[model samples]
Target chain A: MDYKTVLTTCTYCGCGCNMYLEVMDGRITGTIPCKTSPINEGKLCIKGWNVHEFVQSPKRLTRPMLRKNGDLTEVTWDEALDFTASRIKSIKEKHGNDSIAFLTSAKVTNEENFLLQKFARAAVGTNNIDHCARL
Target chain B: MIEEIKKQVRELLTSGTIKGFLGLREIDGHIAPYLFCDAEDMDSMNLGDYKKPGDARYPLNRILIHLLSHYPDEILGVLVRGCDQRGLNGLYSLNQLDPEKVIPVGIPCPPELAEACECSRPYPENRAVDGQAEGYSNQTLARIAGLDIGKRFEYWMNEFARCIKCYGCRDICPMCICRECSLECGDLVGKGDIPPENPIFHLIRAVHMADRCVDCGLCAEACPADIPLRTLYKKVADIVKKEFDFQAGYQPDAKSPLNVLDQ
Candidate 1:
């Protein structure tokens, strides 16, 4: 009996179509376009309609993975971040700042994208930045 | 007109006739479907701005179906335009709704809005607040019919090629109430292919709409690719009418011939 609709914005693209994620017993069951949303106006694209599919997908990554002996191994956040930082440092030292390019994703918030671009320019000193949406 | 509808809703709510009245409410200058449970909230209730039917129109019957599933025993009042009333009747025939437990407060589409929708009948039989308009001919179907066999095939293929596999048409359809959709069957529709095996994808949906489609035009409006889905479904409806002499959502008690074996 715990059926409720949580209004949220679609993260698939920059259009930011507002929709209601229909939750039944704490699980996302369906998506309904928000009729009052000025941006979408009750119309949703393909991605916005199926945005809930990835939430509880069995193939979704739950933990960080690091390659150990050519095989991906699950590791703690600290260990994974440390491994990433150390690898990036070594790669930049050998190949120069121009060699490393930063690829961002559309699934994250604009604030997260800003942080990624900032990290690329300030920390890594590389101007090569792009997004998955671009591809 | 708005005041009259609101007063009727308020009376229905205050008299304990229905637990809730489902209709559009203007919030922040945007009209959206809402369940007005309290009679006091009728002040903000709206019959929807029929002047701009495209923006104001919503699948109110779909929302009503959702609410009815949870509150099965409770009698509820719903605001129904012509298309919404047709959808409600379609749902009733399919056994998805109990007609007795629901009260329909019907409204008719203005002639301009009806002409825009190209709707056959823009007013419900009972409780209409406006006049009905003549149905407009679908030019797209006429154009398609004029083409030869090979050209017709090419025309449909070109249209189907633009499909992004969004399923928006199916999602917005009031008649598509199946728990398991055949379009998603991996065996029928090949996995991981966009534009989904050409005419097969669109044809399957058109066939499904044969006996069930109420021609609300929501599917066409919802499609991002601007596919002429309503025209295709209207053709299916025509076929059903020609072959079975049954029009969906026209009669409450009669069932679609496709659903019955001894029709």
Candidate 2:
């Protein structure tokens, strides 16, 4: 019974097209391009139009997993963060700070990206920081 | 002219004749399709600035169909251009829409837009605002038709090669109403291939547009690849007209020859 359209911006690329995400009962049902948007003018790229598909995709990762006994096993956030920190520390120590690199995603916020680059340069002492959008 | 349409819409809403009026509304200097459920919303209703060339036009009929799917029995009033009226006729013939559940307020396209679209009839048959009809012409279709068989094959190959397999043209088309589209069939169209196997992708869509295309040109407008999709679909419409002596959306009750297998 709860049907509504939430206007938002597309996160796939730099174009930043606006669209309406049709939500029915809290589930993303479809994507409609914002016709009045100054950026897109009611037209959408393929990625912008299919933004809802990934939300409900069964294949999407819901929980963090780590390789244990040569298989991915569900792990708690504390265990996963500790594992990652320890691995990064070992790698940096063994092969120098310059050997470490960080790859960020476009899906995250600008603040999160700033923190990631900061972590790469300040924490890991490496300038090797890049984003997936570049690929 | 827009004032008259708004007045009629307000009357319809206030009299309880229609549950909702689907039309365009201007918000922050941008016009978009909106569902006006209350008489007070009529203050924002805009018939589009016809003086502005190349006005942003959305598929009002497509939005109407989506709304109708949710509220099947409720009567809704929709703003329609000539092409939109034709689309409604085609939908009605196909039994996709219940004629009694809808009302159309017609606004004819201006001469410049009519010529740009090359529309033969730029006004609906009933309750239409006055507008001159422009002769239909498809230079792209004519140019392609003039080419030799080998040249024609090369022309289409080059055109189809630029396709990014976005399916934007299909997604924007108002006449494409099926829940399960054949273009998505894995067997017919191979999976995970960008610019899907040249001729098949374009050909399959062209065939599907045979008796359904209303020459709205929205497909070409939506295509990011700049493919001549409207011309391709127009050719299909021409073929149906020539072969079956039937023009889609011209008559409400007329069934497409392809739909009538009893030929």
Report the backbone clash tally of model 2: 0
Candidate 1 lDDT tens digits, B1-263: 77888888888989999998888777766666677888898888777673375456667787778878977888899988777887788898888999998899998877777777778777776773555556666666778889999998887788888888988888877778999998999988997788789788999999999998887888887877777888889889989998999888888778889987783
The lDDT values for all models are 0.82, 0.82
True-vs-predicted CA distance for residue B101, candidate 1, Å = 2.2
Off by over 4 Å in 1: A1-7, A23-28, A34-41, A55-101, B48-51, B128-130, B134-143, B147-150
For model 2 chain A, give the 10-residue run with minimal summed lDDT. A1-10
In terms of DockQ, which candidate is strongest? 1
lDDT of 2 by residue, B82-152 (tens): 88889999999888888899899888777778778877777777753555556566676888899999998
Off by over 4 Å in 2: A1-5, A23-27, A35-42, A56-95, B48-54, B128-135
| Model 1 per-residue lDDT tens digits across residues A1-135 | 345557789988777898878675688867878766778777797788887888889998899998899999899999999988998999999999988999999889999999999999999999999999888
> For model 2, what is the alpha-carbon lDDT of residue B88?
95
Query: What level of docking quality does candidate 1 show?
Result: acceptable
Q: Share of real interface contacts recovered by each model?
A: 0.48, 0.35
Q: Interface RMSD of every candidate?
A: 3.0, 2.9
